[model samples]
Target: MNIRLNLVATTSLVALLSVSAASAQTMEELIEGAKAEGMLTTIALPHDWCGYGDIIASFKAKYPFLTVNELNPDAGSADELEAIRANKDNKGPQAPDVIDIGLSFGPQSKAEGLVQPYKVSVWDEIPDAVKDADGYYYGAYYGVMSFAVNTDLVDNVPTEWEDLLKPEYAGQVALAGDPRASNQAILGVLSAGMARGAAAGTASGEAGLQFFKELNAAGNFVPVIAKAGTLAQGTTPIMVMWDYNALAARDTLAGNPPVEVTVPTKGTLAGVYVQAISAYAPHPNAAKLWMEHIFSDEGQNGYVKGYCHTARFNTMVAQGKVPQDLLDALPPAEPYEKAYFPTVEEQDANKNAVVSGWDSVVGANVQ
Candidate 1:
């Protein structure tokens, strides 16, 4: 009787082991399981941008079981970084699964070890120049830094960067705050530097400080608080901004004269809002799945609808997702083909220098 009982126990254990092995999930299966877990992914993004709202809505429609808690974080990227640093160990509601921050801040965040490395399967489609080698961050969407000329304010719009220095447009051109205070503004300075024929590493390198000194001297600078819609409404006639923001401005001022957005002939600086998973994410598996979803065809096409460029190389075009006519409206990717994205080390070293130079040279004169 004892031998029969031991054999039955052994048989039961074997059966249980077989069941467990059969139930093990592949990566795809694991993703499905995570979706069913009904977990929430908290995102920190700029509340003012309309594109963000559209992206959030699309994500919810696709994943009804997953909850996305969007936090405004009213503060800019710098403020978000400070908040994250403060809550490193005890991440309160502010602890985010993902963050969408300005291009300039991407490197700093990565170097500080604030980001986690998770390479999405679609990573191969992204250009090497736009993504970090270690997969700490990847640019999800980008905008070319272009000039938004309020045709109503100036009779002859300045088409090129050098044209801004002409005596006629003096005191009319406005930048987005200081370069140090606003990354968009810095890109503007960078664009101007390129137009001025400054080589890389010169004081004028990465948007010439020397050229800005001349602009400041010429009194061509205008000052206005940086917000999404106000600049297009003629708060400041000519301002520098991202292509999406410029297009939105054009749409806003449709009835009242048009705002012309020009990509400088010398090529404009492009800024990307990169995406990264937080190191301390509570739901690591969910975060990885979310990154995969964002890079998928459906997600890439979503950006096109919002008038923003998709990050996926050819997903949108191959799938016939975006209208061909819309392609014409986008600035050719080739002109910006030589665009610069500072490395983590270079950015960290120069961030303070860029900020300090702007403060001493241009900031004091803007107001």
Candidate 2:
């Protein structure tokens, strides 16, 4: 079933067969094939991360006959690739059928020949830059970098990027991870530097590095990687992370300690993650079905529910698929109006530069 189409409409689940790149095998045929396979393995998807808990549950409720096995929820994008390679010879459900990976990994996965092409029904709605030309991978959802604050621990709330460098936030500002290794932390630095007109490239993302160096020197920087629980426990009173994670943390500590997610007025980076099917999926039909579900109205809505922007967010908003409350809670959309997406090549080339510069320029200042 190699039929292909890129319908831009708000495609209904019932009409999926007509729009799917896998249309030659209709929705019914795919469902039947999936049932025969009887199971799907999805790797690196934490149940609570980005509302996967709800999404994975919805999939199970929708198809009770098929079993879905989730493995290594905390695994990284590279780990997902490793899982695919290690299990290529295995036909069991131990092998991942699908993956949700960082954007930088998408093109690399395609180059490695680890991902297969199967465009979702809402293909035309997604931006071309976020998806591979041959449909090997496509963006699922994206989150903007933001400040997560523990309201109970800190009296003053920072609503701007510059606020983190203040003496008030001394020893309070924490990164999501080491800038040299963490995608989230690197982005936090990038967002800060870019907002101040910093250029990001192979020359060590200097603007970002310089901004972070100043932050560290101010005694505001903490070397620890802060998680939601860390903020709740006051280990790191302020954290730089994705808005969805901040929102999720807020919801988690609803009553005891208020957690507030802030999108800096100066600007922030929107981090996009892509989804792809394994080239050697043990259950290819189930993998295709999974993709169909993700790009459908229901699936895209899941992204909104998780506080992340769906790839087809604009289309969904125009179609009124997103509710007003969720819309209201979203970080102000203006900063994202001019959001920049670094190309895969740029991400790779500049990574070493950033890491090298971090050690020399920023790391020493970090507490």
Candidate 3:
């Protein structure tokens, strides 16, 4: 969904839908169905990203009858889709029942028949622009791209995309994931390109590749994927990742190395992550219950606690469902005011350009 709706407009939509009603399944019936199924498998959800660790734990505590199976927490969006495809015929722990993926992947996965349609009880609260008309996939939460710096190692934290090219930042900057396969990195490239004056679609994707090529040639781009541990160890002193992830990392680091998250003045790209049930999910009922739990006020607030703006964030705020403490914890709302939210077509075009050209254009071969 596009951020052009603005919070006020979205709140208005939520108000309009408040009296319209919600999904059909009752919580008790879903719980009973889930308990009979007894298991829920998921993939590519890391404890440190978007406060998912606590969310998962809460789900387990709330539904003690079901076993939560997690797989490859570090896998990227592409890997998640691959897991669904690889396990289409399998019904074991490797088979994921639910998926939290990049926006473009929602439609792509739905098109490939990897995901099935299922709307949550709070469906009415979600913005129409972000959710599928047929309920195939819906946004969960979103965050803008930002720089996570190890303050102990960096005297000057870059606040603009161009600042990363400065000589002082040599061998210090790194992307959070491999651009070829990771949606975050692919979008990271688009953000940088937008800063360099390229338009949003394929042009930005190509421009981003050239930008990274320069960074690599100048010895300022680290080929290794950057994360909390890598940032603390100084392997990647400047990590480019989602603001939520960077903030979570800062909290996780707890001042050991002094972490700082900064949203760049230019190319402030906002990325939305959506959720969907797997078409081949062995425990379909449990998956539906999991969706209901996450889309609930508690679940939306759970994401907010991790610094993500949930799909129902505006609605929850209007309803006074979000805690004051969580509101205070978020990064300044001013930067996000100018954050760009690309449409699915733009994202698909940019993703294709970045993925197909990364090796040929940038040649980093990031591990």
* CA error at residue 53 for candidate 3, angstroms: 1.1
Candidate 3 per-residue lDDT, tens place, 42-116, comes to 898999999899999999999999999999988889999999999999999899999988888888997787887
lDDT tens per residue, model 2, 131-218: 8766778888878788889988888999987778778888888876667655666667777777776555554367778878898888
Error of 2 at 356 (Å): 5.9
lDDT of each: 0.62, 0.76, 0.88
Name the lDDT of candidate 1: 0.62
TM-score, every prediction:
0.77, 0.83, 0.94
Q: Which candidate is the best by TM-score?
A: 3
lDDT for each residue of candidate 1 in 1-367, tens digit (9 for 90 to 100): 0010111102245434533542343467646766765554555444334255566677777667777766543445665566567667854556677767766687777778677776777777676555776677787876667777778777898778788889988767777545664556656666677666654233334456767777778987666544435554556777777667666667666746667877776745556667777767655556666776777776665565555665763555766766776666665565355455444344434445566787666554443
Q: Model 2, residue 115: displacement in angstroms?
A: 1.1
Alpha-carbon shift of residue 265 in model 1 (angstroms): 0.9
Model 2 clashing residue pairs (backbone): 47-53
The 10 consecutive residues of candidate 3 with the worst lDDT sum are 9-18
lDDT of 1 at 335: 37
Task: Tell me, by lDDT, which candidate is best.
Answer: 3
